[model samples]
Target: MRRVPGRPFEPEEYVLETNTILFRVFSTGGMVPRTVTDFNPGKGDRTRFAFFGDPTVPVLYAAESEEAAVCESILHDVPSGPGAVLYESFADRVCAPLAPTRDLSLVSLMGDGLFKLGTQARYVTGTMASQYTRTVRWAEAVHEAGFDGLVWMSNRRNTDRAFVFFGDRVEAGDLVALPGTGRIFAAGAGFDWLADYLTSLKIEILIP
Candidate 1:
């Protein structure tokens, strides 16, 4: 599917999605109109409706009920790779920051929660390793420079670094929250703020 603007990466902690969606296609037989519809996540994952010109006598809809009469459906791409489908959502979670096309530094925070650097080389997310990036900037300062980052599993963006960017200002011990998993990744004026912000929101799915 094409990436939509408003779509959040995915929740870091726990991600869930339907295994498959229901689709319907109606034939008009030169009398009515044939309709096609796909199951979406909005207005609930399941639904039913009746519209005129439904030449097939039934309407098109997407739902999860066992009683649902479907014309056709495709299964969700369950990842067979090491860590693909293992997570709940789509691989786009890891795909985003790793998406080398982006402009930012993505460090790892590992399950142990420590600051670690990466070899992104800019403009390509082809990862050299599967380590989790941390948000805490220990030595580098983020106040003087603009910062951008997100949390894993959570789809929130942390712009809290604005306070540091505008002024040569910073408190001795100030803290900020990340998007996906609301965890305190790091503290420092040297590192970019967005890095911590993004490391927090982690959602991913593998496409095969």
Candidate 2:
């Protein structure tokens, strides 16, 4: 690979351009914004977010972030939880990495986006869990299945969202890549920014 700049640049990146049809479903799935105002990030955060694009390979769309995104609920930082903090911490196989709660919290803080690893990512850096194996698991269904991406309808500023692109629908539209199978697409009714994008409902990676 060419020398990776401080910021890895993807020359073949694209978006769905129009995925409103799918996002309408995401909104109905209760994944929509709970509070429109909460969607907006501080002015400082918004500015920074715009400048820094997502880095996941085949990076899809970016989700709007919230100051109080209730991450603690999903990523418990306490001493113990129902599962391992970093699933990788306990993983012997590479396809089923687990990240209980604490691990999620730790990794989430390591970068700007979630579960993202670009071809340009530094040597031995920015890897969350290498447990996912596409050859043995239906990972494409999740990453490359049909879903393109999920964009948060946020009005926030700097605090931006993270994403994991699915690649099943490569022919879908304008989207960011998520390593192998992740894609980003437009799903909502008025997300004009994503005129050619297609968000995914579910993903499944094929096990070869």
The best candidate in terms of TM-score:
2
Off by over 4 Å in 1: 1-125, 128-130, 133-144, 148-208
TM-scores vs. true structure, each candidate = 0.14, 0.21
Badly placed stretches (over 4 Å) of model 2 are: 1-10, 20-38, 43-73, 76-208
Question: What is the C-alpha lDDT profile of model 1 across 136-193, one tens digit per residue?
Answer: 1211222112222211211111111100011112111121111232111122321223
lDDT at residue 134 of model 1 (Cα atoms): 20
Q: lDDT per prediction?
A: 0.19, 0.23
Cα lDDT of model 2 by residue, 94-180, tens digit? 110111111111112113322242322222112222312211122222233233433222222224433333322232323222222
Per-candidate RMSD, Å: 23.9, 18.9
